[model samples]
Target: MRNVGAFACGLLFGLGLIVSGMANPAKVLAFLDLAGHWDPSLAFVMAGAVAVAGIGFRLARTRSASILGAPMQLPTARRIDPRLIAGALVFGAGWGLAGFCPGPALVSAASGQPRAWLFVAAMLAGMALFAALERLAAVRAQRSQSSS
Candidate 1:
């Protein structure tokens, strides 16, 4: 039941992205072209999304469990640290360059977009690299602890 609900939500989200032109790299790039022929259509879409998410988060914060009977796992981090800044910079750079963030990239990739496929592949490689580096760090930390 949970899997079905998740699939349904994901499908709806993908459809929304497609309908909003977010799945199209050209449209996204046009939106990002602030100095050039800027398209402000996506700003409305983003504003609407932010508004909805804000309300949802507010409501979620009052709840101990999700509507699905699962624990409500929300982000607890509030401080903007160096890691957060670096991550935001990397994310912004990728989005600006490729014109496809993770969600939209996944939608476009599923629709067989070549550039989206490349983006998703690179995204997966980055995730893998990060995981490997984290593992190496953990191993070094463990070794140091054991040696001491």
Candidate 2:
């Protein structure tokens, strides 16, 4: 039942993205373009999303567990570090270039668009590379600690 609810939620979100023109890369590109033919429609969508998410977060905070009886696992990080800034820059650049963030990219890929497929492929490759690099760094750090 919980899995079904999760699936329903995902489906609703994808549908909302499609309906809001968020699944369209061109629309997203237009939204990001400030000096060019910019579209401000997505700003309203984003505002609505943020407002709803804020309300949901407030409501969720009142509960110890989710509707499915599972404890909520939220990020506890509050400090903005170099890694966070770098990651935000990378993410913003990726979104501006590809015009597709993770959720919208996945939704767009369902439409059989070549651009969407390429974006998803590159995104997966980036994720894999990052993981590998992090693992290597951890191993090096552990070895250095043991030697010292």
Candidate 3:
């Protein structure tokens, strides 16, 4: 049941990407190109997405928990630390270089864009780096506990 629901949701998301012209790397690249031939259609699409998600999140906040699940796992950390800054910098640079972010990269993976591969590669590298950092932090925490 869960697998079926997940598959359906993924299918809908992919269809949305296709419908929004987000699955085309050239379209994305053109939108990001501010010099010669800048296409602004993608900006509208992104604004629509932000509007929808913003309203949805606001609605969700009014509820204690989802009907089918527990309370949303919202991040509560408010500190602006070095890790956050570094991660944001990396993400921004990768987006500028690839033009297609993670959502579009996954959608266009079926289209065989070389730049899409680079986007996915960098995305996975970021995730792997996060995992390694988390492991190191755990080790350091354990060492401190033992020393104390």
Best-fitting candidate, scored by TM-score: 2
Task: List the candidate 1 regions with Cα displacement exceeding 4 Å.
Answer: none
Give Cα-based local distance difference scores for all models: 0.95, 0.95, 0.83
Q: After superposition, how far is residue 55 of candidate 1 from its true place, in Å?
A: 0.9
Q: Per-residue CA lDDT of candidate 1, range 64-87, in tens?
A: 998888899999989999989999
Pairs of residues clashing in candidate 1 = none
Worst 10 residues of 2 by lDDT: 68-77
TM-score: the better of candidates 2 and 3: 2
RMSD of 3: 2.3
Clashes of 1: 0
Whole-model lDDT for model 2 versus the true structure?
A: 0.95
Clashes of each: 0, 0, 0
lDDT of 2 at 92: 97
Model 3 clash count equals: 0
Q: What is the TM-score of each candidate against the true structure?
A: 0.95, 0.97, 0.82
Segments in model 2 whose C-alpha atoms lie over 4 Å from true places: none
